[model samples]
Target: MTETVKLKNITIVLNQPRYPENIGAAVRAMRNMGIDRLIVVDPRDYDLEKIRKMATHGCLDTVAAIQRQTDLKAALESFHYVIGTTARLGGQRRTGKPDATAEKIVSISQENQVAVVFGREDRGLSNEELRLCHELVHIPTAEFSSLNLAQAVMIMCYELFNACVPSKPAFTPRMAQRRELDAMLDQLRDILIRISYINPENPDYWMHHLRQFFTRIQARAREVSIIRGLIRQVDWYAEKRYRDGRRDERNRIMGKGAAECD
Candidate 1:
């Protein structure tokens, strides 16, 4: 039987994996879930024999097809949306923002070329590396949150595998892409600055909150277009009113000077 074509578009990336065995086992997990693309970033020099020995079953083909990259950023360059798997928060992550779950990850994967990054075996992802991701995900564990690298890959794949079955009611809105959303936000930032909604001295602070609020809302592309159009309208009206007010003030002054002459 031919392999199922589920999750055909999702690319799995392993970053700085230390063990050949884990790589081998990850192939099996991927093959089991019909995930064909595997990207490895700066992995240790591993013996293919060691990898093959650990990759039991008919998963050798998956092992053979692994793509190598010098760094995680290079590996993920093509994917528009990336999800980083980490239990701990790092860098400039907003405080107390909950992680996107497996379901949430799968939800975005429907329309986007999603790349899910698994960090190094020893320390997980560095804060700088995590910044590359659009979101972070964690598998909920009771006592021990740290899952084995292969185990983590398996869990994510399994969840994706189960969740990716053809959608039933089919009324889901097309989610806005990062590029599109970022463009709208850019326009919004300019309008906000024009209106003085953003503090001139600390624009980043105001924008940071607005970004968080909109990111939380997860608005659709159509929805974001509406918001952007509204901002344009507000700017248009504000300028018009300012011009009209200036004209009326000039007329009043001219009339007062005529009365004084009389």
Candidate 2:
């Protein structure tokens, strides 16, 4: 008997959703697809009664268990992997198909908490929010690409459900959580700025590429620690060299003064 994907480890995050009905319907869709965890961040309008009406009594448990947050970063801090759903694609908004993305999610879900984030109904995830995601899933459509919030959730959830198969054994360990990665990135940014590797005025521009590289590798906790350690060593060495140079200059100046006095 093959093991199935860990659906319990998967969470659906709705970012700045505007309608309670859509939230309720999204809850129903999640329940149908066997994904129970739901997190709502900075909702524009949230009414329990209105949500429950659309979710129906059958999905009361899911609606009741929904977690609410005021910040997207805080909501995603504990998750090891995050996938953002988007319809528009260009430039930095590169995306993967739902099926392929689902496979990757299934593998990562084995040992990490995974989150699938959806943006507001009017406009999808902003560039800043999308930056938080390790990957993006785009549901293909005709030239007309607009999709309802609930509909997009249902489709992604269905793909995840369908891909719940025993993935091939790989080194998919408990990867570093979002918070850990963010901390490392912050440290790295400061060090890079000190060394003039990245522009202080626009450090994030270069840091974004480094973040993408780390995300692509699915860095583990130990790996992140090692990177941080390397960064600290670099910082220490740079400081030490500067101090040594200053000391040598002072000695040279003092020696010249003594020679003149003699």
Tens-place lDDT digits, model 2, residues 1-262: 3445579999999999999999999999999999989999999999999999999999999999999999999999999999999888788777999999887676778899999999989888888888899999999998887789999999999998988555354547999999999899999999999999899999989998898998888999999999999999999999999999999999999999999999
lDDT of 2 at 78: 97
How many pairs of residues collide in model 1? 0
- Residue-pair clashes per candidate, as listed? 0, 0
lDDT of 1 by residue, 1-262 (tens): 1221138768889999999898888887887877878888899866788788787758777778888899776677566566788867545564221232545545555555777789888898887676556677766678757678988888878777765334442233555655666677778888888888887786666776677566666667788789888988998998999999999999999999999999
Task: Kindly give the stretch of ten consecutive residues in candidate 2 with the minimal lDDT sum.
Answer: 163-172
Name model 1 segments beyond 4 Å from true.
Answer: 1-6, 89-100, 105-107, 164-262
TM-score of 1: 0.62
